[model samples]
Target: MVSYTGAVTPGGPAQTRQAGCLTITKLAVDPKMSNNAYLLQCTETDELVLIDAAYDAPTLLSLIGDRSLTAVVTTHQHWDHHRALAEVVAATGATVVAGEPDAASITEQTGVAVDRTVTHGDRIAVGTCDLTVIALAGHTPGSIALFWAGSDGQGHLFTGDSLFPGGVGNTFGDAAAFESLITEVSRKIFDVYADDVWFYPGHGGDSTLGAERPHLAEWLERGW
Candidate 1:
C-alpha cells in the first residue's frame, strides 16, 4: 500500500526536481514504553530508512522486498524502539545507526555490527536528502533528531521523543538527565532549525517549529 511517505524541504534534491518530499509510512507497533517506529521514503529517490523498530519483527521484515535501505536509525535504545531491531537487521543486513550509550546495547541486541553512532552535527545521506543527526539526550543518554532540509522553504524534523506539539517530550524516562536534555534540544535542534520547520514527532500527528517554539519558555519556567 502507498503511504504518506514524507514532508518536503526547500532546496532538497527531490523538491528541486518537483519530486515529492520524504514519504513517511507509519507501522503500528507496541510501544512497550510509549515509543514508536516509522519508515521514511525519499520521494525523489525512493530510498527507504526505518526510524525505529518498536513493533513486531516479522511484519517489519515482510515490508522489505529486496529494497536497498540506506540505514536503520534508532532515535534511542529503549525497549519499545528496539523490540524489533533484530528482525530489521537480520532482514535487510542494513546499517544499524544510533546514538551514544545505546550503541553498545544496540550492538548487543542485534548481535551485528553497528553501521554508525549518530551524534551532534553528524549527517547521513539518504536518497536525495541529508538527515542531520541533532543530539537531544534528555530522553536517553544519546537521543538524536533527524533534521531534513525542505524545498517548500520549511524544513522537516523527525524528533524521536525530544519535542512534541504542545510541549517538548517527556523527560521522565530519564529524570536525572531531563534538565540537560532541555538545554541540548535548545542548543542543537531549536537553534539550528527555524520556527517554520515541520516537526514529525515520535507519537503524535504533526506540528511546526513555530508552534513548538513558544513552549520553550514553559520548559525553562519549569526549570526544563
Candidate 2:
C-alpha cells in the first residue's frame, strides 16, 4: 500500500506499488547500467511475472523468493536488457516471452530459447491478471511494451527502451527507425492512454504520460 513513486537506485531498495489486483515492484540493477527490472505479482494468487531480467541473477532470484514465476518477459533483445535471462530462467524454470522479431536474437545472444513469441494485442496471463503486449518496433526490430490496466482505473505501462520521459528510445541515427518508434509511441501509446497513466522505462525513474505529453511534439520536431 506504499505510494508508488517509481523511483529506484542501483543496488538500493526496491519501490513497490499496490494497484488494485496487482503488486508492482521496480528495482534498479547493474549499477553501471542503471537498468530497471519490474516484478508483477497478482495479488489474488501470488503468481509472478518478471519484466526484463536485465542483470544480477542472484538478486533477481532473491526478489522472487518462494514465489512462482510464471514467466520472464523480455521487452526487447538488447544485450543489457537480458543479461541475467538465462540464469534466471534456469533457476526459476519460468517461461520466456519476447517479441517475435527479436526472440531469435535474444536466444542467439543469451543461449536461452524464447518459450513464447508475442506481438501487439497479445495478452500474457499472470495468474488471474493479464498484460497486453504493445509492440513499439523501432529501437529494435521487436521492441515491446507491456500494459496493465488496473482495476483502479489507472494504466501502468512498461516501456522497454522504446519510450522514455524526455523522448523515445535511441534509434542510433536511423531516421526510419526513429520514425517508426515515434509514430508507434504516439498512436499506440500517447493517443490511446490518458494523462494519468504511469510509465516505467527500461532505465531510470518512472514518469506519467501527462508529464511527458507536452514534449512529444518537441521530440518529434527535433527528430531524436
Candidate 3:
C-alpha cells in the first residue's frame, strides 16, 4: 500500500512510498546542500540500487538494512552530491556506476573508482528491475537521469541536480550551460515523458512533470 507523507522540506526526514514492485525511499542527506539520496528496491528480488550518496553514510546504510545493494549510480560528478559516496561503496561493496564523461572526475573526487560507465539508452539492471539512463547535459557535462516504469503504470524519474521543481538546476551563471540544460530537458524529458511522470530531484521536494511543464517558456524568459 502506498502512503503519502507531508510535503518535503529542506533537510526533512526520509520519506518512503510503494509503487507496484518498486519501493522508493528519499532521504535528505545534507542540510546545507539539501542533497537527496534515493534507495530503490525491487520487491521481488529484494535487490536495490542507490542513486547519489550525498552525506551521512551510516544513516544511508542503516536505511538499507539487510537488503542487497547492487550498485551506486552517480548522476553527476558534483562534490555535494557524492560526498559520502566512498564510505557507502566501501561499506556495501556495491559497484559504482557513472557517466563516461564524468567518470574520471567522479573517481578523483570520491576516491572510489567507477566500475561502469553508462551513456544514453543504457539499461542498468537491479536484480529484477531495470532503470534506463537518459543523458542530461547542462547542470554538469555528465549529468544523467534514471527512468523507471513501474508495474502501477506510472513513470518515476531520478533527476540528480538537473531538473528541479521551479526550473532547471543552476548552471553556475553560465548562459550557454543554462541553454544546453534547458534544451536537453525540453527535448528529452518534457517531450518524451508524460505529465503524470513523477520525478525525485537531488535536493528538496518531489514534483511531477505536469507541475513544471507549463512554465517552460517562463523559465526560458527568466533564463534561470
Candidate 3 structure quality by residue, lDDT tens digits, 96-166: 99988899999998889999999999999877888999998899999999999988789999999889889
Q: Give the best candidate by TM-score.
A: 2
lDDT of 1: 0.70
| Candidate 3 accuracy as TM-score | 0.95
Error of 3 at 70 (Å): 0.9
Q: Candidate 3's C-alpha lDDT?
A: 0.88
Over 74-159, each residue of candidate 1 has an lDDT whose tens digit, in order, gives 88766667777777777777778998666987677666566788778888777887788888877877788888776676677888
How many collisions per candidate?
Answer: 12, 0, 0
Tell me the spans in candidate 1 whose CA falls farther than 4 Å from its real position: 1-21, 31-34, 109-112, 173-176
Supply candidate 3's per-residue lDDT for 15.
Answer: 79
Question: Worst 10-residue stretch by lDDT in candidate 3?
Answer: 1-10
lDDT of 2 by residue, 90-111 (tens): 9999999999999999999999
In angstroms, the error of model 2 at 149 is 1.0
Task: State residue 108's C-alpha deviation in candidate 3, in Å.
Answer: 0.6
Residue 71 displacement (Å), model 2:
0.1
